[model samples]
Target: MFTLIAAMDENRLIGTGRGGLPWSGITRDKQHFRDYTAGKSLLIGRRTFEEMRGWFRREDRPIVMTRNPDYDPGGHCRVAGDLDDVLALAADSDGEEIVVCGGAELYRLTLPFADRLVLTLLHADFPAREGGVFFPEWENEDFVELRREDFAADNQASPSMTFLYLARRAGSEHADC
Candidate 1:
Protein backbone atom coordinates (compact mmCIF):
# COMPACT_ATOMS: atom_id res chain seq x y z
CA MET A 1 0.00 0.00 0.00
CA PHE A 2 1.04 3.60 -0.55
CA THR A 3 1.37 6.18 2.21
CA LEU A 4 1.94 9.79 1.15
CA ILE A 5 3.90 12.02 3.50
CA ALA A 6 4.17 15.81 3.37
CA ALA A 7 4.42 19.11 5.26
CA MET A 8 2.49 22.15 4.19
CA ASP A 9 1.65 25.64 5.41
CA GLU A 10 -1.87 26.93 6.02
CA ASN A 11 -2.00 28.01 2.38
CA ARG A 12 -0.97 24.48 1.36
CA LEU A 13 2.35 25.85 0.09
CA ILE A 14 5.04 23.25 0.39
CA GLY A 15 7.92 24.77 -1.57
CA THR A 16 9.41 28.12 -2.36
CA GLY A 17 11.64 29.48 -5.16
CA ARG A 18 14.57 28.36 -3.02
CA GLY A 19 13.92 24.72 -3.94
CA GLY A 20 13.42 23.18 -0.49
CA LEU A 21 10.84 23.36 2.28
CA PRO A 22 9.55 26.88 2.82
CA TRP A 23 9.61 26.60 6.59
CA SER A 24 12.27 25.46 9.02
CA GLY A 25 13.03 24.60 12.68
CA ILE A 26 10.22 22.11 13.14
CA THR A 27 12.45 19.38 14.51
CA ARG A 28 9.61 17.34 15.98
CA ASP A 29 7.79 17.20 12.69
CA LYS A 30 10.99 16.16 11.01
CA GLN A 31 11.46 13.41 13.54
CA HIS A 32 7.90 12.25 13.07
CA PHE A 33 8.58 11.87 9.35
CA ARG A 34 11.72 9.88 10.00
CA ASP A 35 10.08 7.58 12.53
CA TYR A 36 7.05 6.93 10.37
CA THR A 37 8.89 6.27 7.11
CA ALA A 38 11.90 4.56 8.58
CA GLY A 39 11.77 1.24 6.80
CA LYS A 40 9.40 1.91 3.95
CA SER A 41 10.11 2.12 0.25
CA LEU A 42 9.92 5.74 -0.92
CA LEU A 43 8.59 7.04 -4.21
CA ILE A 44 9.74 10.57 -4.97
CA GLY A 45 10.24 12.93 -7.84
CA ARG A 46 13.76 13.48 -9.12
CA ARG A 47 14.11 17.02 -7.82
CA THR A 48 12.87 16.04 -4.39
CA PHE A 49 15.21 13.09 -4.39
CA GLU A 50 18.14 15.34 -5.24
CA GLU A 51 17.23 17.86 -2.59
CA MET A 52 17.16 15.12 0.05
CA ARG A 53 20.02 13.07 -1.38
CA GLY A 54 22.37 13.36 1.57
CA TRP A 55 19.74 12.80 4.24
CA PHE A 56 18.42 9.31 3.43
CA ARG A 57 19.45 6.57 5.78
CA ARG A 58 20.91 3.32 4.49
CA GLU A 59 17.73 1.36 5.22
CA ASP A 60 15.50 3.68 3.23
CA ARG A 61 14.92 2.63 -0.35
CA PRO A 62 14.07 5.54 -2.63
CA ILE A 63 12.48 4.91 -6.01
CA VAL A 64 13.01 8.12 -7.95
CA MET A 65 10.58 9.02 -10.70
CA THR A 66 12.02 10.70 -13.75
CA ARG A 67 11.44 10.58 -17.46
CA ASN A 68 15.14 10.67 -18.23
CA PRO A 69 16.43 7.15 -18.27
CA ASP A 70 19.98 8.46 -18.13
CA TYR A 71 19.55 10.45 -14.98
CA ASP A 72 21.31 8.84 -12.07
CA PRO A 73 20.40 9.55 -8.44
CA GLY A 74 23.87 8.17 -7.40
CA GLY A 75 22.56 6.47 -4.31
CA HIS A 76 20.92 3.18 -3.36
CA CYS A 77 17.73 4.34 -5.09
CA ARG A 78 16.01 2.72 -8.06
CA VAL A 79 14.94 4.89 -10.97
CA ALA A 80 11.56 4.63 -12.64
CA GLY A 81 9.90 6.38 -15.54
CA ASP A 82 6.63 6.93 -13.74
CA LEU A 83 4.53 6.13 -10.72
CA ASP A 84 3.45 2.79 -12.17
CA ASP A 85 7.03 1.72 -12.42
CA VAL A 86 7.63 2.73 -8.84
CA LEU A 87 4.57 0.79 -7.68
CA ALA A 88 5.75 -2.28 -9.55
CA LEU A 89 9.12 -2.06 -7.86
CA ALA A 90 7.50 -1.59 -4.45
CA ALA A 91 5.29 -4.62 -5.08
CA ASP A 92 8.39 -6.72 -5.50
CA SER A 93 10.11 -5.38 -2.41
CA ASP A 94 10.02 -6.97 1.03
CA GLY A 95 8.81 -3.76 2.62
CA GLU A 96 5.26 -3.57 3.98
CA GLU A 97 4.55 -0.07 2.75
CA ILE A 98 5.49 2.42 0.03
CA VAL A 99 5.74 6.07 0.98
CA VAL A 100 5.16 8.69 -1.69
CA CYS A 101 7.48 11.56 -0.87
CA GLY A 102 6.91 14.47 -3.15
CA GLY A 103 7.44 17.52 -5.28
CA ALA A 104 3.87 18.76 -5.80
CA GLU A 105 3.46 17.16 -9.22
CA LEU A 106 4.19 13.68 -7.98
CA TYR A 107 1.78 14.01 -5.08
CA ARG A 108 -0.90 15.30 -7.41
CA LEU A 109 -0.33 12.35 -9.70
CA THR A 110 -0.10 9.57 -7.14
CA LEU A 111 -2.43 10.61 -4.33
CA PRO A 112 -5.36 8.55 -5.59
CA PHE A 113 -3.37 5.40 -4.99
CA ALA A 114 -2.33 6.33 -1.48
CA ASP A 115 -3.90 4.34 1.35
CA ARG A 116 -2.71 6.70 4.05
CA LEU A 117 -1.58 10.29 4.42
CA VAL A 118 0.81 11.55 7.08
CA LEU A 119 0.82 15.32 7.00
CA THR A 120 2.31 18.17 9.04
CA LEU A 121 -0.01 21.12 8.80
CA LEU A 122 1.73 24.37 9.73
CA HIS A 123 -0.57 27.09 11.03
CA ALA A 124 1.40 29.87 9.31
CA ASP A 125 0.89 31.09 5.77
CA PHE A 126 3.70 31.23 3.18
CA PRO A 127 2.91 33.78 0.55
CA ALA A 128 4.83 33.70 -2.69
CA ARG A 129 4.99 36.06 -5.60
CA GLU A 130 3.46 33.75 -8.22
CA GLY A 131 2.22 31.17 -5.75
CA GLY A 132 4.38 28.23 -4.76
CA VAL A 133 4.24 24.50 -5.02
CA PHE A 134 1.24 23.17 -3.12
CA PHE A 135 0.18 19.89 -1.64
CA PRO A 136 -2.63 18.44 -3.68
CA GLU A 137 -6.04 19.26 -2.30
CA TRP A 138 -8.28 16.39 -1.16
CA GLU A 139 -11.73 15.94 0.21
CA ASN A 140 -12.03 15.44 3.97
CA GLU A 141 -14.88 12.97 3.66
CA ASP A 142 -12.67 10.52 1.79
CA PHE A 143 -10.40 10.01 4.75
CA VAL A 144 -10.75 9.23 8.44
CA GLU A 145 -8.30 10.82 10.80
CA LEU A 146 -6.42 8.05 12.52
CA ARG A 147 -4.29 10.31 14.71
CA ARG A 148 -3.52 13.94 15.48
CA GLU A 149 -0.90 15.61 17.61
CA ASP A 150 -0.55 19.35 17.97
CA PHE A 151 2.72 21.08 18.73
CA ALA A 152 3.02 24.70 19.77
CA ALA A 153 5.22 27.11 17.85
CA ASP A 154 8.79 26.62 18.87
CA ASN A 155 11.46 29.33 19.25
CA GLN A 156 12.71 28.87 15.70
CA ALA A 157 11.16 29.41 12.28
CA SER A 158 8.29 26.98 12.74
CA PRO A 159 4.71 27.86 13.39
CA SER A 160 2.19 25.87 15.42
CA MET A 161 2.01 22.56 13.65
CA THR A 162 -0.39 19.64 13.75
CA PHE A 163 0.70 16.25 12.69
CA LEU A 164 -2.17 14.29 11.23
CA TYR A 165 -2.43 10.71 10.15
CA LEU A 166 -5.29 9.84 7.87
CA ALA A 167 -6.44 6.62 6.32
CA ARG A 168 -8.70 6.27 3.33
CA ARG A 169 -12.21 5.45 4.45
CA ALA A 170 -13.48 2.06 3.42
CA GLY A 171 -15.62 2.04 0.27
CA SER A 172 -14.45 5.48 -0.76
CA GLU A 173 -13.58 5.69 -4.42
CA HIS A 174 -9.99 6.70 -5.15
CA ALA A 175 -10.74 9.36 -7.66
CA ASP A 176 -8.64 12.43 -8.44
CA CYS A 177 -10.73 15.58 -8.36
Candidate 2:
Protein backbone atom coordinates (compact mmCIF):
# COMPACT_ATOMS: atom_id res chain seq x y z
CA MET A 1 0.00 0.00 0.00
CA PHE A 2 1.13 3.55 -0.66
CA THR A 3 1.75 5.47 2.58
CA LEU A 4 2.58 9.06 3.40
CA ILE A 5 4.05 9.92 6.76
CA ALA A 6 4.58 13.52 7.83
CA ALA A 7 5.40 15.49 10.92
CA MET A 8 3.22 18.60 10.81
CA ASP A 9 1.40 20.97 13.16
CA GLU A 10 -2.16 21.80 14.17
CA ASN A 11 -1.78 24.97 12.23
CA ARG A 12 -0.40 22.62 9.59
CA LEU A 13 3.00 24.08 8.79
CA ILE A 14 4.88 21.14 7.33
CA GLY A 15 8.10 22.92 6.39
CA THR A 16 9.75 26.15 5.33
CA GLY A 17 12.96 24.81 3.82
CA ARG A 18 14.44 21.41 3.25
CA GLY A 19 16.11 19.07 5.75
CA GLY A 20 17.24 21.73 8.16
CA LEU A 21 13.72 22.84 9.10
CA PRO A 22 11.87 19.73 10.25
CA TRP A 23 10.56 19.60 13.85
CA SER A 24 13.59 17.53 14.81
CA GLY A 25 13.86 19.28 18.15
CA ILE A 26 11.49 16.41 19.02
CA THR A 27 12.75 12.80 18.78
CA ARG A 28 9.80 10.37 18.83
CA ASP A 29 8.64 11.50 15.43
CA LYS A 30 12.15 11.05 14.13
CA GLN A 31 12.32 7.53 15.46
CA HIS A 32 8.92 6.71 13.93
CA PHE A 33 10.13 7.76 10.50
CA ARG A 34 13.34 5.82 10.81
CA ASP A 35 11.58 2.70 11.93
CA TYR A 36 8.85 2.98 9.30
CA THR A 37 10.95 3.95 6.31
CA ALA A 38 14.35 2.38 6.83
CA GLY A 39 13.89 -0.10 3.99
CA LYS A 40 10.99 1.27 1.96
CA SER A 41 10.58 3.30 -1.19
CA LEU A 42 10.02 7.03 -0.60
CA LEU A 43 8.42 9.51 -2.99
CA ILE A 44 9.37 13.17 -2.85
CA GLY A 45 9.66 16.40 -4.80
CA ARG A 46 12.95 17.56 -6.27
CA ARG A 47 13.70 19.90 -3.40
CA THR A 48 13.01 17.24 -0.80
CA PHE A 49 15.10 14.76 -2.79
CA GLU A 50 17.99 17.19 -2.91
CA GLU A 51 17.82 17.79 0.79
CA MET A 52 18.32 14.12 1.53
CA ARG A 53 20.49 13.36 -1.50
CA GLY A 54 23.66 12.15 0.13
CA TRP A 55 21.77 9.83 2.41
CA PHE A 56 19.76 7.97 -0.30
CA ARG A 57 20.31 6.36 -3.69
CA ARG A 58 18.60 5.38 -6.95
CA GLU A 59 18.41 1.74 -5.93
CA ASP A 60 17.09 2.49 -2.48
CA ARG A 61 15.75 5.70 -3.87
CA PRO A 62 12.99 7.88 -2.71
CA ILE A 63 11.49 8.61 -6.16
CA VAL A 64 11.37 12.23 -7.24
CA MET A 65 8.62 13.83 -9.34
CA THR A 66 9.63 16.83 -11.39
CA ARG A 67 8.95 18.85 -14.53
CA ASN A 68 12.55 19.30 -15.61
CA PRO A 69 13.28 16.85 -18.38
CA ASP A 70 16.95 17.51 -17.86
CA TYR A 71 16.50 16.17 -14.35
CA ASP A 72 19.18 13.62 -13.69
CA PRO A 73 18.53 10.43 -11.79
CA GLY A 74 22.04 10.53 -10.24
CA GLY A 75 21.76 6.80 -9.56
CA HIS A 76 19.45 3.79 -9.92
CA CYS A 77 16.37 5.79 -8.85
CA ARG A 78 13.46 7.12 -10.88
CA VAL A 79 11.91 10.54 -11.69
CA ALA A 80 8.49 11.39 -13.07
CA GLY A 81 7.22 14.41 -14.92
CA ASP A 82 3.72 14.06 -13.53
CA LEU A 83 1.54 12.41 -10.88
CA ASP A 84 0.37 9.64 -13.17
CA ASP A 85 3.90 8.53 -13.67
CA VAL A 86 4.68 8.72 -9.98
CA LEU A 87 1.66 6.60 -9.07
CA ALA A 88 2.29 4.09 -11.83
CA LEU A 89 5.91 3.49 -10.94
CA ALA A 90 5.15 3.22 -7.27
CA ALA A 91 2.36 0.73 -7.79
CA ASP A 92 4.46 -1.37 -10.11
CA SER A 93 7.43 -1.56 -7.81
CA ASP A 94 8.21 -5.09 -6.63
CA GLY A 95 7.38 -4.09 -3.10
CA GLU A 96 4.04 -2.54 -4.07
CA GLU A 97 4.56 0.18 -1.48
CA ILE A 98 5.77 3.78 -1.36
CA VAL A 99 6.17 6.32 1.42
CA VAL A 100 6.18 10.08 1.03
CA CYS A 101 8.50 12.31 3.05
CA GLY A 102 8.09 15.91 2.12
CA GLY A 103 7.90 19.65 1.81
CA ALA A 104 4.15 20.59 2.11
CA GLU A 105 3.34 21.25 -1.54
CA LEU A 106 4.12 17.66 -2.36
CA TYR A 107 1.87 16.53 0.47
CA ARG A 108 -0.95 18.60 -0.93
CA LEU A 109 -0.51 16.94 -4.27
CA THR A 110 -0.10 13.42 -2.96
CA LEU A 111 -3.01 13.25 -0.54
CA PRO A 112 -5.46 12.19 -3.22
CA PHE A 113 -3.31 9.22 -4.06
CA ALA A 114 -2.21 8.09 -0.64
CA ASP A 115 -3.80 5.19 1.22
CA ARG A 116 -2.38 5.77 4.69
CA LEU A 117 -1.06 8.74 6.63
CA VAL A 118 1.23 8.93 9.59
CA LEU A 119 1.12 12.41 11.03
CA THR A 120 2.70 14.26 13.92
CA LEU A 121 0.33 17.09 14.74
CA LEU A 122 2.28 19.86 16.44
CA HIS A 123 0.66 22.31 18.86
CA ALA A 124 1.38 25.35 16.75
CA ASP A 125 2.49 26.58 13.39
CA PHE A 126 4.39 29.79 12.61
CA PRO A 127 3.34 32.69 14.81
CA ALA A 128 1.71 35.00 12.27
CA ARG A 129 1.54 32.68 9.29
CA GLU A 130 -0.01 29.97 11.47
CA GLY A 131 -0.36 27.60 8.55
CA GLY A 132 1.23 27.54 5.16
CA VAL A 133 1.43 25.06 2.31
CA PHE A 134 -0.85 22.48 3.87
CA PHE A 135 -2.47 19.35 2.46
CA PRO A 136 -6.25 19.52 2.14
CA GLU A 137 -7.87 18.75 5.46
CA TRP A 138 -10.15 15.73 5.81
CA GLU A 139 -12.96 15.14 8.31
CA ASN A 140 -12.80 12.49 11.01
CA GLU A 141 -15.11 10.09 9.18
CA ASP A 142 -12.64 9.98 6.32
CA PHE A 143 -10.05 8.03 8.22
CA VAL A 144 -9.69 5.25 10.74
CA GLU A 145 -7.28 5.88 13.60
CA LEU A 146 -4.76 3.10 13.65
CA ARG A 147 -2.63 4.37 16.50
CA ARG A 148 -1.49 7.36 18.52
CA GLU A 149 1.70 8.08 20.42
CA ASP A 150 2.31 10.89 22.88
CA PHE A 151 5.53 12.80 22.78
CA ALA A 152 7.71 12.75 25.86
CA ALA A 153 6.51 15.10 28.62
CA ASP A 154 9.68 17.13 28.36
CA ASN A 155 8.71 18.24 24.84
CA GLN A 156 5.66 20.21 25.98
CA ALA A 157 7.24 23.13 24.22
CA SER A 158 4.51 22.21 21.67
CA PRO A 159 1.83 20.74 23.90
CA SER A 160 -0.97 20.09 21.42
CA MET A 161 1.24 18.02 19.18
CA THR A 162 0.41 14.33 19.03
CA PHE A 163 1.60 11.61 16.68
CA LEU A 164 -1.11 9.80 14.72
CA TYR A 165 -1.42 6.98 12.23
CA LEU A 166 -4.54 7.23 10.12
CA ALA A 167 -5.74 5.18 7.16
CA ARG A 168 -7.64 7.10 4.57
CA ARG A 169 -10.89 5.48 3.52
CA ALA A 170 -11.25 4.11 0.02
CA GLY A 171 -13.31 6.08 -2.56
CA SER A 172 -12.47 9.42 -1.01
CA GLU A 173 -11.15 12.45 -2.82
CA HIS A 174 -8.68 14.65 -0.99
CA ALA A 175 -10.22 17.89 -2.16
CA ASP A 176 -8.47 21.11 -1.18
CA CYS A 177 -9.95 22.71 1.91
lDDT of 1 by residue, 97-133 (tens): 8888898988998888878999999988877535578
**Candidate that would win on TM-score:** 1
lDDT of 1: 0.85
Cα distance off (Å), candidate 2, residue 31: 2.0
Quantify all predictions' global Cα lDDT against the true fold. Answer: 0.85, 0.70
What is the lDDT, from 0 to 100, of the residue 5 in candidate 2?
A: 83
Looking at model 2, which ten-residue stretch has the lowest summed lDDT?
A: 126-135
Candidate 2 off by > 4 Å = 17-24, 57-59, 124-132, 155-161, 170-177
lDDT (tens digit, per residue) of candidate 2 on 64-131: 88889889968767898876676678767765677888766677777767678888777665542333
After TM-score superposition, what is the CA distance of residue 142 in candidate 2 from its true location, in Å? 0.9
TM-score of candidate 2 versus the correct structure, residues matched by position: 0.78
